[model samples]
Target: MDESNNNIKEPEKRAFLKGAGLSIAALLVGGLSIERYAVPKDRSVPVMDNFPLAILEDPSGQPVTTSEVIEFAGAKTTTTSSPILVFNYPLQDEPTFLIALKGVKITTPNTPPSSGFAPVPSGTDAPMDGIIYDSTTNTSILAVSGICQHLGCVPPFLDYHPGQSVPFESELIGYKLNGAGVKKWPDYGLIYCKCHGSQYNPVWGGRNLYNNGPAASPAKHSLPQIMLATDSNGYIYAYGINSSNAVIRTHLNFPGGETYGSGVKSEDLTGGTAIRQSTRSLPANLSLYKNTTLESVAPSSLGTNQSSGAIILYKTTVVSNENKNGLNWKGTF
Candidate 1:
């Protein structure tokens, strides 16, 4: 076998942080006793009535222009509670141009974007970032956070041949199991974690085996995904996401904990028939809203079929709340 043919892609470098004794529970938005369920608002356009809506004005208090996009990573850095940012206005310092972002992915970009952008290390707490290059549209500037949602570990990106076979050891690029039962060699994605033997997918969104890893179901849920999008001007925006969801939350508990009811934090009970107690760190139980009912009997009996006789049903198909254990509440919405 040729040595060149044996070259394997390395796993993306990941960061890790100690989270013991910390209240990892999610902050219930707007503060309410029981979680309230509501249909999501349209995110296609600006529907939020909150402050800091418009991009912060530039010094000398002038708006940004197109030429400015070429400078300082495009328009003014936007901050919002909605998680997604945009750059639709023109820069005051440069040529006039428009920039807009839809959801997390950049559906549009202006001019030819950069070919390849490097990751800028902002700070210890600053989320890891990356850039995307799109040739089809002639735009390539993009950025995203690189922290892993599973236990606050960072993911290391491995560069490998796109369409070639590689060695398992050379390809070993992530945390793997070692010692009695702990993480060791947090390098070389081996689909094994030294800390807990938690297997991870090598190709983005890969599968995880071993205990302490996300369960197998809708395999897509195995990997944490970063939200990304670009504006009409070519600047990219990326966001981080938690991996736990309704389906996966169950796997989050210690084998002896309570099985019924949904939530994140669990109490460790060593007794027989032990029940797992949960803390506020988990998502609320599955909630259902009445969306369907028996059609009007009058229509059938009276032989007068009308649109009112039909019933509709609305259920939560799937939700990954991100905060706490997102996997705690999977099922029919």
Candidate 2:
């Protein structure tokens, strides 16, 4: 009886082993087939075409010239009331700052010497590479990406702070006028980010001035500059983007991939509808820490036409106090 039981057990074990072997072989074959089909046949890098030259237009469909920007921004010392101009270039959803640094004359490829600060490496274009100059008045006009390099904050949270005019948020974050005591900040107007305290020097190609402060610059790269040009008629046009290696926030193709060289990725440029025109208007009072009141509403005609490929540039009036109507105060002083 023991011998008969052993014989039956051996045959059953053999049958089970045969079945397991077949299952494992089938799985391996299936996995190989899937892998073969899943591999992309074309692994070539995408061809990125150069962006088309887009004319900067105001809300009224008029071309925005360098002279107009200089006049609106005024002189650096007296530009306390001038509003930050906003526009879209290359793509409609990509908001850009159109700034004239008051009395500052920005020269091309304005990369500062690497004395104590890390300058942009040689062979790469600096933020000033995109500056447009008015030959008649020698006024310097520049456009930089409005999106914060840290966390993609838009205007108001990532706006410019002119000299002598300190925002409540700026003072709270330790950015003084001219960086008086701050070792990290520059001694001039900065494109400051209130979100995480990233400060960019407008005079030095939107270079990030990060070191030691209550709120230091969290961004590792400078703001991407938009290449500007003027026709014989003095109309400013955005032709391309400089600082191609510095990726624009929210404009990345892959999850964590490098941007296409030559200042822009053609695939990204064509992803969104191009904004044909933008108007000079006040920024929205969206500060959670402060109460804002609309002093004077911009023209409703231009504001309502935002869906028609036009952007309303909201003027930012950051004040020292909070709970005030129309005053944009983001933090305590």
- Top candidate by TM-score: 2
RMSD of 1: 22.7
Can you write out model 2's per-residue Cα lDDT over 1-333, one digit (the tens) per residue? 011211111110111122223323434554221212211232232212234345565543556555666656554443221477666544443456777754444544344433433322342222245566443554457678776665555555567776656667678876555544453334345787655567776655534444444565777767777666555456665655664436565555433544546444332432333333223332322111001111222222211212234333311111121222232322221
Highest-lDDT candidate? 2
lDDT of 1 by residue, 208-298 (tens): 2223322221112233222222334422222112112111211222354223222211211111110111111211111111111112121
Residue runs of model 2 more than 4 Å from their true location after superposition: 1-50, 75-81, 108-128, 178-187, 206-215, 254-256, 260-267, 276-333
- Backbone clashes in model 2, listed as residue pairs: 281-313, 281-314, 281-315, 282-314, 282-315, 283-314, 283-315, 293-325, 293-326
lDDT of each: 0.20, 0.46
> Can you tell me which runs of candidate 1 are displaced by over 4 Å?
1-133, 136-152, 155-194, 197-199, 202-221, 239-333
Q: How accurate is candidate 1 locally (lDDT)?
A: 0.20
**Model 1: per-residue Cα lDDT at residue 14:** 10
